[model samples]
Target: MSFLLTSCSTYPVEVTSADQLAGVWEDFAGRTVEFKGDGTFTATGMDEADVGEECSGVAATQQGALSLSGTYADVTFDGVDCEGMMLAFYGSPSSFVVCFTRDVTAGGCTGELSRKDDVTATGRHE
Candidate 1:
């Protein structure tokens, strides 16, 4: 008898607009990034070693815990325009959305990759 084996690899989707990435993604270590629909984003525990630092992009708001309000710039795969953060969002079929670590001098993302199922929205319109 003879047997054959094959493997298939899946690739993550390159997120272009903020609408597609509007959600909260968490990694295995609880690291998370919330891509608000209002063109803003919030990142928590971005460090691999568990840092209790929370960063909110664009405007700050009291809407609630982990929320952003007011008009803000668009966040794309290229980078974020606020807080000197460089976050890159992507889509994955296996999970939901994802954020990958970048190679930059400024805040070019942290952790390896984060993915979650929950979603929260605001604006993110042109």
Candidate 2:
């Protein structure tokens, strides 16, 4: 005689929201990033972070639009500044991926932007 057994595992995945990305996010290199509901974004930095920072184009997203598009000019990063465009899809409010052209100085930086996670918003860093 023989017996069979079955097992399964489950994990929880966090969902993203447009509101989560509405605030400003800064990188380790002191860069301020803000995403607006109108499919617009603004980034400010100094030196390396501001090598080619410029907002050239604009876009819009409706209530049901799942993707966002925009253009940029003289954006800089990683010691390289170039002009290019960026297309980002809605992931979670905390995380997102920006696909851009070669106009910016830096390549692509992927990370999370969370105001709640960073206590600095409340003047506390711990």
Top candidate by TM-score: 1
TM-scores of the candidates are 0.41, 0.34
The segments of candidate 2 whose C-alpha lies over 4 angstroms from its true place after superposition are 1-20, 46-84, 87-126
Q: Give the alpha carbon lDDT tens digit for every residue of 1-126 in model 2.
A: 111111110111132444434666554344455655543456554232122235322211111112222222222222222334333222322343332233223433333222434535443322
lDDT of the structure predicted as candidate 2: 0.33
Model 1 per-residue lDDT tens digits across residues 1-126:
111111111233444445655777665455566767655556665432222123332222212221211111222222323232234333343333333323232222334344364322321111
Clash totals for all candidate models: 3, 12
